[model samples]
Target: MGLAKQQEQKILYISPLSLGDVEFQERNLGLPVRAVNQEEFIERVFGHFKGHLCVFLKRADGTPSNTFYKHSEKERMYKYLQTTFGINTYVSYSTFYQKVKKHKSDILRTQSNIVHTYMLVQDLDYYKFGMTDAECLQKIGQMVAKGELICPTFIVSTGQGYQLIWLLEPFKNIAGYTNDLDWRRIQDHMYEQLKELNSDSVVKNPSAVTRLPGSRHNKTKNLVYGFLANEVTFTLQDFLWFYDIVPVADRSVKPKKLNKKKATVTTIVKNWNEYTLNKQREEDIFIFVNVQNERGKSYIGIRNWLALVLRFHALVSSDNDTEYAEKRVKELCEIMDMSETDEEEILRRSLPAETYYKQWIEDTWDRNKYLRGGLFYTNSRMLELMDAKEDYYIQWKMKTIKIKNAKYEAARKRFEKYGEEEADKHTWEAFQERRNEKLASDKADKLWQLEEALDRHPEWTNKQLMEHLGWSLRTIQNYKKKLHK
Candidate 1:
């Protein structure tokens, strides 16, 4: 647990939909030296007792540790018990092993047998509850026997009081949740109901951790064990008793006014863009990193996202034949500081798409805002699939071409109608005349080179020069004619 806390609660990090289950798993920790899978560990803990189980431990310092350590077959943890000022002291910083077991998100999402509610019994509050710890356990056993309240699957007698855990049945329908917002709704409803009954004390958040069975309480120094029955199971429907426990709708005296204290913590920033990609979002194959019209903002996280987008584009858009994809890829390669050859190999490699492509897209969308409509196409789903459906690509393409000469308008129209190849070829001259465009400098440089070559190699004919320069004879002849004029 300490290690997990250090890594921003890595073990506890779960899909919002799974938060309820994560909290439940936190509470029902296995009171043993070694941790095992959820089911086996639950079985071992609820099974018949063998020896003293170490539930909690503390270092020389008084700091509390959220973990339980040690399991042995002999000398029930009594050896660790100590008399402190006439009172037995066993553990301070004590915790049991807890693991969600399903490390992969996909597998864990499918699991439904999440603990819905947890019950905590303590001796410290017997005065308020008006029942001794033993009396409370007896009443609980009676309730179970009569089927009024569901029997707790596992019950532990902590030195201070008693801890009872009731497990809910598996709920298979866990997907398609709306922001994982409703998993704890039942817990809240139950809490309100308990408040009406004035026994809200028993209700604890599903994330709450109880004292590991077989461990001694730190202050009480008494051993903990299963109270009544060793094993049990109940349906989620069984929890309806909490509603009946209070039954607030009645003609009665006025309810007491409850005072509330609220604490506010301000956060400088928050990312509300967390999303799980559906099949459509998953198939969005290309992410074009474009500079927005506004000032460019840079961050290390966005830079890494840019690299990820480029890599995915090369992987999925590799088969696309459009000049649009090719041109965009070239620009992206330059921005990435990778050579065209490296880009080609990345495109040609017969490898699977990134395993975390969906995650990358979600993360990238949140971090960067330079994404433009040029990345997405306006028409043709097939073209969208071919070009990654970025909203900025066509918008950018339109904006860029219009800034050039009017002659390029027809080609832009042709691009919308006849696609990249015909459009680019038709717009070639206009593009060449526009200083802002790539073709203009390219044509100028070619003409300069031809003029230099004619002076240096006067003996070479136009055909030989054409062969060397990979230019058409017609183009060379035109250049020479222009030179003479």
Candidate 2:
């Protein structure tokens, strides 16, 4: 028969734990052998004979020792296998010890007994067949190209001493294990090889490799590429680059609908023109009287006077002779400080040529023209000035609230000193006295000044008169009524 097909040879190796040198009593010979600590001895003994034993060694009761051992001892043992036996030996540590303990018997039974070692060695040899530096680098580069290892991974070295390094991305994982060694050497070699491979082509292209599509990546090409043609020098450019790369989602933005209701510009302009014409007529009536008094002219310009009169009546008539017209006329008379005769003259000039004062009055009063819209058809500027006055009044009212509150508080305190009935009687008498005093003082100090203004500017209309006196229409009217009375 052809030489018995050599049974596929398999080897089992086990490492002893906590061994020491001992002198045997019977042989009087010093022998260095494998011994395990008492705690580990049971597991080690079972590991040796559990597998087919081509060779085996055991040491018992060798020396008193703890788990700690010298590095020299470990190295010496490792050296024995590598140098004398031409075998690679891996020293088992705590991690390997735990692994062996879990599968104690299975490892021993399946393996051949060629190696002269215990159960621990058989278990640890499984991981000892690790990849070399070159093989490890190749795997890391492949992982990076596939985008499997974008983050850092670790590597360990068994030569010289136990060392570890963390491999970062870009240069691949092998750069980590290089420690202090120059990795640029490896990089240079790789670059040269890549260049040689592309030498035949005018346009050098990267080799095809699988990678997840980055936000900046072109999926159409299976090659590495850069977003920038050159390096960025400015800080703003870096920000712009990052911003451009960020993905933006589409969203619907609707335009807002405006009011778009056109204002009544034509109506406003027409009303404004009419208001100006009426105001001019009022001014002419005042001016004509002033001229007559100053020049000692007995006769008036009838046409000019009648024209002014018609304009005034038209304005008053258009307002339907509303209550506001009466009020405005009263304010005008008070502001202008005109005598009854002077008022009569102005009204006469404003009336129709055929109509007498009595009939005009009857017609105006009967038709209730003064009770209609009144001066509502006035200029927008006048309305704006009125609105400003209203705002000032509101502000004054707000200010008065604080003053009133303080006065009330003081009154309350004063009243508390007297009985409630006596306090009410005294407070009312005092309030009346204070009011009379204030009224009298206000007329002398403020109303006199307004009167002087009216006397000096007899030609002014109500609005113009109020402006000259720097007073409100209401204030001027009140003072005029008091002065006339």
Candidate 3:
């Protein structure tokens, strides 16, 4: 015998006319040209059909409802497909799939045994009031004949929450079995199922019921669950949808208030300028010395050079509001008796302020000695040249020289009085001698105290004797040895 083969049914998909275009055509206006192909037409019909069914049917329990208008998961999936295949294929697939998924739950629910009693009654009443009682009964009978009865079972165990089980008819006419079926009938059936399911209670017997793991409703729930478990990839559409839901806070986007206590560089410069302007003075020496003291240089010449550089810088910027950098340079050159060429050379050699100061100090120190007029010299001729308080200058010089001489003398005496090895040996000997002398004095005092303690407590043992005097065994023995000697 040969196996019987089922014939494939060929369904002709009619593309849906736009409501606006249909209205225009009814008024005898020219209609828009239809640009869709057979495949595109089929896809559009299927998508619309699926969407209609989905809207009518209730979303399966345990699956999250689509609260936001923009589908985040679908968008991400579409992008992934586009990257993998091609943009055209991704667009076609995404458009069709998105429409189908929208009404998938509704269609599946209509096929199940779970009929919504509320919608059924409502529809029956509508027909009765709109038409005749006979028409209402006739419609009701037709629905009952085509409808599948679903026995829903819910279970709750020790740990697990209530689980729902829906027992559906093996074969029945779903809401939209054929394209000829009325959409109103389909919606009524779906609503009826929802109402019935809501009224259903959990079943007690766990063994009697056979559990079908992956039903249409369960599969839909699982698909949604998996999608949510993965991170959601948001698009611009998603952001707009979010904005509609929750608005951003004003304070969050606002700039922070700045601290009032802080002072800027501009303020510091302004204050310094004002102070300088207030302290206007007559002709100052403006001595310009190149303070260069580094790499084997005299401290005296370096100090003088530093003084000159500092004075030159001060004089140039002394005007406060106005800068006299050029004038200061000319005055500095005149004071130093430097020619134009020399001045240019010096300016070129000096890089940054710190580098200039360093080089100047180093150069001055290298050529000079500690003369009586230098910074190191208390009674130097340079100090006499400057018109300042003689007493104050004298005092400062004396103090500085005294400190310097003391330090020098100390270092010199240490070297001359003792050789390296002898110095270390003498230091150690002195320390040891002082330690021994202190120890001897303590011992003598303790001996006298011990004698008095013994006289007061004659019955004391050696341990008790040592304990009372806070002496160790070795110390007590040594004291006894000294007594014997």
Q: Highest lDDT, which number?
A: 1
* Candidate 3: tens digits of C-alpha lDDT, residues 387-458: 122323122222121122443344335445674334443454677988999988998997787778778997
Off by over 4 Å in 3: 1-323, 337-341, 349-485
Would you estimate the TM-scores of all the predictions?
0.27, 0.14, 0.14
lDDT of 2 by residue, 1-485 (tens): 11111111111111122133312210121112232231232222223222121111111333221121222343443343234221111221111111122453543211121121211110001113453434433443343334232211111222211111111111111211221112222222223333312211211111111110111112222221111101111111111111121111111111122223433323122332433444443543345334444545432213223233334434433333434333334444433434323655544443432232233434442322122111222222221211222222222212111122344555555556664446555666788998999988977977678677768886777788677777899987777787788
Give lDDT tens digits, candidate 1, residues 114-221: 222223222223325665654554555444344333334444455655544554443322222211122233445534433322343433333334554444555656
RMSD of each: 27.4, 46.3, 38.9
| Better candidate number, 2 or 3, judged by lDDT | 2
RMSD of 3: 38.9
User: What lDDT does candidate 2 reach at residue 114?
Assistant: 19
Quote model 3's TM-score. 0.14
Worst 10 residues of 2 by lDDT: 3-12
